[model samples]
Target: MEPIKKAYGYVTRTHKGRPQVLVFQHPILEAGIQIPKGTVEEGESPEAAVVREMIEETGLTEWGKPVFIADDRWKADDGSIHHRHFYRLDQKDVPDQWQHAPSGGGEEEGLQFTLFWISSPGDIPLARGHGDYLPDVLEERPEDGLGCLEPSEDVKQVYLIEEGVERIIGETREQISFEEGGTVLVREQTLTSEEIGDRRTVTRLMASTNRPLTVEDSGGGGMRAVYAGDHVIIERDGGEKRVPLHHLPVDTFSVELLLRTLPLEGTYALSFHAFNVLKGEEQLIEIHADEQPDGSFKAKVRFGAMIQWYWVNTETRELLKQSSDPAPGLKMEFRR
Candidate 1:
């Protein structure tokens, strides 16, 4: 049979003085751990194919040029011959780990992969001989300051919050869906309790590495946002307004939602301007994270004089508990 051309990538970086290689694992346990690789398309050079495969399979939006490494030919179990080109690309400034349902056709269309870095690929092993060429291309890397913390991969979370004699129940789900344009990452959350006025449901959607395209809060004055060009078109209280969102000088009003996705390190801090959807006014918000002695993490989500503590698991990134005393004599708690 004629040979099928393919390209494979060894996306490498440094975290805390250790050399690391990027890899992924399919949700289906049998697929095993893997590196970003794919079949080269007709008329496409292997170099171009390498980058395209890395982006599509690994969900990386930003990357540098790839350096050609080596080549090999192998016969598949199906008796088809395959020619593979391997390349190495350096990566920078990204979260420790993230999840994405690759954008493409074929058996990968709906499969989600948990993408992360490992100091050694052989330790965990990549399925289907995906690591065959690792010994030829692996190299020590200089520190990139990417930090060592990795968010857990769990997509479904449930939490219970309490205050004084009152309680609030919250549940969140994270997933990817094939939409009109392509794959859209979605986070849906619901909040309810015996509290008289605290029933809320929020849905957030993001395209690629882009900021949120929509943030719908059914409880907070019916606040909603739609991405339009470089600005966010917000609809509320029978009126609409637009606000600018940028890439650099990164700023976000969706701090609470972002915490679920950001990799939490021993120390994390960011200050940005945010629109108070409930107040209909712009305000400054600050969020900080620090590792606890128990290996879990806590983030201070403060708004005005009220501060809430978000506790998350170190390895799983699961929300273990959250508590806040918003007012005198009132303590609120949420436990998973």
Candidate 2:
């Protein structure tokens, strides 16, 4: 029995606004079944081999980073078992250019490939003989309890919006702070609120100096103003009557300290933990910046109806830090 080797590939494409998944396709000896897989070469590193195999099959060249997902072992037809390491490749866009030309590597004669769009992990049909490892691979990472590891320090920033105003807040290394509202120049404008009970109420607020501010009512309750910058925004709401930008009573202490400091760009995980305060609930926050971008970074966050802040560099669109208090029962913890 010959020991079968391992390999890897990703289900990817250049289509925008789609999630990518990793997969490999190979013809099985029996009939009608093709195995998508990650293959391991004799001398190449597992990571490098997957990249090479992906390029050969998909003709894509812009794989950004590979995250190790899991590993599996299975018995082959020849009475031998092989262990294959798997990874999920993170990429925003597939490259436009790809070459079908093989770089002249091992086992080149027996390879064939294609790309797939996996809507979910369940879409991938598993081989009957292989033990189920997809569950472990697709398991969501714990949002809390994950300690900062890679780049050591991290900064989380958020933008809270109400009416036509936006306030930036930051959380770094467990310390929460606020950016100076005075330094954030805004253009003054007036707009009439939607007609309410025979009264057309009007309100005045500041708009972003760099970009147009979008104004919309926060449902029927209040107003939400959003300023879309390169990668950040300033928002304000009149209904909350909190005056987040010009004056934030809860965040006043850290305004001076935050404005004086410059935040570095990096990969960070921001965790918002809600604690019950006397009047209501407050947030205990933490930020982990493990990787840095040259000038800008992007992150997608979901909130449970709580206000958040973002500290964005005026020139680079890079997110410096974000801070927020979770709403009632929505608290998160991360573990690494």
> Which candidate has the highest lDDT of all?
1
lDDT of each: 0.62, 0.36
Give the TM-scores of the predictions, in the order they appear.
0.44, 0.34
285-308: candidate 2 lDDT, tens digit per residue: 443333325444333333334344
- Estimate, for each residue in 163-220, the C-alpha lDDT of model 1 and write its tens digit: 4355334443332232332323444554444433444434333333323445677775
Q: After superposition on all CA atoms, what RMSD does each candidate show versus the true structure?
A: 16.9, 20.7
Alpha carbon lDDT at 170, candidate 1: 41
What does the lDDT come to for candidate 2? 0.36
Residue 225 in model 2: lDDT: 34
TM-score of 1: 0.44
Show pairs that collide, candidate 1: 152-316, 160-334, 160-335, 161-333, 161-334, 162-332, 162-333, 163-331, 163-332
Q: In lDDT terms, how accurate is model 1?
A: 0.62
